[model samples]
Target: MLTAVGVPAVVLLAAGADAQRPVEKPAAAVVAEAPPCCMELVAPAPAAFSAGSAAGGRIEWVASSRASVREARALPAGVAPEQGLQVKTILVARAVSAIFPEIQSIGGVRPDALRWHPDGLAIDVMIPNPGTAEGIALGNQIVAFALKNADRFALQDCIWRGIYFTPGGARAGGYGHYDHVHITTKGGGYPTGGEVYYR
Candidate 1:
């Protein structure tokens, strides 16, 4: 049974409950208008993606589950912690942060010489407790989410846990992607609103 918390807006789902809800126009509007909240509800991306180990010479793609969060709820707006990021980049960063509250720090527009960061096209989602098992799992989920929503976000690539993921496929051995997930997006105009979604 679904139990109501002190706030009507907050409902704690039972363990293992499939919290996925049908996408509604009102929910989309809420996501667009709601102020960024770290405790916003998020649904794990359904379906799986192909992945391969970095050690292999020929990448043998295998199916990997994308769902990670325990339950689903309406997606809320997100905040951009770092500055100097593109408008599209900011929107995506906000979406990611709202989807994953564990991610507290997001780095953007750094002086990486000629890299994507210097061009304000990249954002780093730093993983908390990166050495722990939970951290690894979170990183995996974030990567999966990014890959799943690549076209919607105009994502170029996502690197995490030594693996590089694109809309097409994923390959391991991405250097320096241990503690954080790196996401790069193609150039795009500012979002008019309701561009991000959990489903």
Candidate 2:
């Protein structure tokens, strides 16, 4: 885990410019902005497990509830609703789906055996061909979008193609992230004010 810090600006003063001149001070420090989303450029990792098994079984395709459908519609275009998804997860899923409709599915909530999946704060968008050029481009685009709008989306962390992003930085690690972009939220829902988990 990493914490967010403020970035300071330095001001260099000329030596002996004027005896009585006042020196200007910098404004309040700004929170350190995260580096560009795609910091590591490694080749997409090979899938280590079957997508179905990783997601815990065949994805359920039932119609979304009225509220869930409405939340999905609130997202950007090209988002296909997944049944039984929580509202917050649906919002996160739609954000990625809006960027890449080619995603085979967006998974929410793992089976009982997988404890890593948070009840409603996480989502996994499946990319069928991560090694292909198109797949790579789509992955990059999704990451870039997430980084650009991390605050708006209340993103706590994101992982894909063996790379993960935190408010502190993006680094390479994790297995089975090759076939999907996994996103986790900060507060289990939209954050109010400056509430961010990674920060």
Candidate 3:
């Protein structure tokens, strides 16, 4: 029964009252965007931006929910079971944040991008120093982090221009294998049998 807490005295329909209207799922929030210049992650970021590094470098965007927030919300008190996907997305964001703290700007990417790709665990970032040697090194480190942590969570795909790895946990059908690396986490993370992409 839904209750309107307004001045008008209202009653929620009896426990099994017919729903007044079809429940509408809230639109998924636009979290982040990936840019062409950024690179994948392998491990945690270096403590200090290499002094040798310059401004406007490549970056990875991170959404707020790609972490473990999903498990808790899976059965939210007021939410219906049908919201699993949304809940799962929230989890992915939480997991990503847990696994990758270097990602800081997922929301910078606009909804309308030149090439918009959607990956469950991916958060887009804008790297300004992509053209510099430091940028290249930065990208390599991130890729290494992603490869190590694939098993930590389920990932739809990891798309690095040169080459990419995919977790064998789920989405092994390889639907977009040719287009991108499909990765799914076994909850704990992707640990082995993963491939590496290189330039």
Candidate 4:
């Protein structure tokens, strides 16, 4: 994991000024600031597994009850939220965007009162022509990535093609979510804060 740090300014004195007076110049240091809401670029996480199978790419549980460890507001730096996702969800969106260029939009924060959507902790990774073979393949890859990096993104659950994936493993049944991959973070519906990491 990468950490952000600040630089210090430097002071230089001119040689041979006056006997009592000297010229001093200060050089300011430049520091890169992370965007508001703990937004930072992250390298792709190391793969936990190579394939997506019941026995191949099972997600290991490494989740947090609270998504953010520090106080943050608004979305990540470049992530565009569909509805109104929480900070942690936006971080996941940003990670997906960085990893998968084919993905265009992500849906967040809905009116569903019974689930994580309305709380802004869930996201729908929209897929184009999801019924097609290519689309399914891409969704599977994404699901596999999510499962592998469950700890990095603080993921709680991932659902694709009506199949649910947790750190425990994958299970099938139910309906809907065929057009997009649904993912939820650790937080329940409530105000979220803190930093989010991609890897």
TM of each candidate vs. truth: 0.56, 0.50, 0.31, 0.56
Of candidate 2, the 10-residue stretch with the lowest lDDT total is 65-74
Give residue 20's error in model 3 in angstroms.
53
Best by lDDT: 1
Candidate 1 colliding pairs, count: 0
- Clash pairs, candidate 2, are none
What is the model-wide C-alpha lDDT for candidate 2?
0.46
How many pairs of residues in model 4 come into backbone collision? 1
**Model 4: lDDT of residue 79:** 42
lDDT of 2 by residue, 1-199 (tens): 0112221111111222121211222111111221221111122332133444324422222112111110001233224343444444555566555445567687776664544364566777777787776665556556555665576556777787777776567776654588777777653443343211110
Write model 3 residue lDDT over 85-128, tens digit each, in one string: 22223333333333334444232112334322222223333333
Tell how far residue 131 is off in model 2, in angstroms. Answer: 1.1
| Whole-model lDDT per candidate | 0.56, 0.46, 0.28, 0.54
Better by TM-score, candidate 3 or 2: 2
Best by TM-score: 1
On a 0 to 100 scale, what is the lDDT of residue 133 in model 3?
Answer: 51
The deviation in Å at residue 166 for candidate 4 is 0.8
TM-score for predicted model 1 compared with the true structure = 0.56
